[model samples]
Target: MSKTMKISESLIEIAKPYAEAQHRSVPKQIEHWARLGKAAEENPELSIVFIQNSILALAEEKAGMATPYSFGE
Candidate 1:
């Protein structure tokens, strides 16, 4: 279970509309933003497209679509 916490009304208001539009709950929407914010902070040089591609690559790997790397070819 996740810990419960309080957030400002302003933040809730900002999340609510987007959450509804995205079909996510307010908390889920906030968590998604937090994850992206952390990823952006960690990889300052990476573009959003790069980040998304990286995520897709990871998903494909988990689904057994990735091949082993060849160091020399």
Candidate 2:
């Protein structure tokens, strides 16, 4: 369910490098930023680093790349 919308050329240009670096499409890069911004706005007490790391950890878990952490092992 994707829709076409107008976006600034400068924004697209800014997203290009980040998109490439993250191995995502330009639209996905913008979406990622939007998601982070939304999370930050909703969770004012949470740091951006924590939010980003949490998202990464969730992704890793979903992709079956995460392992259980041992306690004091």
Candidate 3:
């Protein structure tokens, strides 16, 4: 069985620029980080940047606040 969840439209909007900057689609970006998260659980060398950034992005969206970070800017 596969579990599912909903993502905020605001979060999607906020991540758009970053995803575009990385030349990745939003789904691909999320998958990339999901893999990173899994790998981080098994490896110590992976940076925590994605974890922190994703959390902050989600929190900002939930609170109806603007994102403070942007890639390639």
Candidate 4:
């Protein structure tokens, strides 16, 4: 369920390269940024790098790419 909305040209320009690089549509790239911002706001103590890695880890898990972690004895 998506709706049409107006966004700044500057934002579109900024998102274009990132969207292409990430293999996501411009809207999806913006959505990903929004999600990152939301998580950052909610967990002020967490670094952006950590948040990004966590998101990637979750995505990998959802896509069945995660493996069990083995701790060294």
Candidate 5:
């Protein structure tokens, strides 16, 4: 099956910078975002746990349990 849809130029402009930084085209960037969104929608608990873990990670940093970013071999 196949379908056609319309997308706005303004939206493309908004996504251009991110796509360029990631070495991808605008359409690929949009498709990647769409896939992530679909997965999040299908698994509500996954999104909730992701948010919770992010908050906990920040708290750990504030408490000095985590080290600052350092590159090593």
Candidate 6:
């Protein structure tokens, strides 16, 4: 369950128009941006392309085309 918190008016103002343009709900658009921000912070050396490709790879795995990794001698 997610808790509702007060958001900054300026932030909501920024997100609302973009959310509408992207056909996403306001909260969902904020969530998407939050995910990107968190990922960038966690992986400073990674490019946006790399992060996007990783998301695609996870989707493929969930659809059953997984390539599990193993390191062995």
Per-residue lDDT value at 46 in model 5? 85
- Order the numbered candidates by TM-score, best leading: 4, 2, 6, 1, 5, 3
Error of 4 at 49 (Å): 0.5
TM-score of 6: 0.69
Question: Candidate 5 residues 1-73, lDDT tens each?
Answer: 8576677899899889989997889987887667667767877778755754665687799998997687894
lDDT of 4 by residue, 1-73 (tens): 9789999999999999999999999999999999999999999999999999999999999999999988994
Candidate 1 versus the native: TM-score? 0.68
User: Can you give the lDDT of residue 26 in candidate 6?
Assistant: 91
The true-structure Cα RMSD of candidate 1 reads: 3.5
How many steric overlaps does candidate 6 have? 0
What global local distance difference test value does model 3 have? 0.76
Give per-model CA RMSD. Answer: 3.5, 1.3, 14.5, 1.3, 10.7, 4.4
Q: Tell me the TM-score of each prediction against the true structure.
A: 0.68, 0.86, 0.46, 0.88, 0.56, 0.69
For candidate 2, give the lDDT of residue 28: 95
Q: Residues 1-73, candidate 1, lDDT per residue (tens digit)?
A: 8897999999999999999998999998998788777878899999877776787688899999999999988
- How far off is residue 9 in model 4, in Å? 1.4
lDDT of 4 at 1: 100
Between candidates 1 and 2, the TM-score winner: 2
Which stretch of 10 consecutive residues in model 6 shows the poorest summed lDDT?
48-57
Against the reference, the lDDT scores of all candidates come to: 0.88, 0.97, 0.76, 0.98, 0.77, 0.87
Cα deviation at 16, candidate 6, in Å, is 1.4
**Residue 37 lDDT in candidate 4:** 100
- For candidate 2, lDDT tens digit of each residue in 1-73? 9788999999999999999999999999999999999999999999999999999999999999999999999
What local lDDT does model 2 show for residue 39? 92
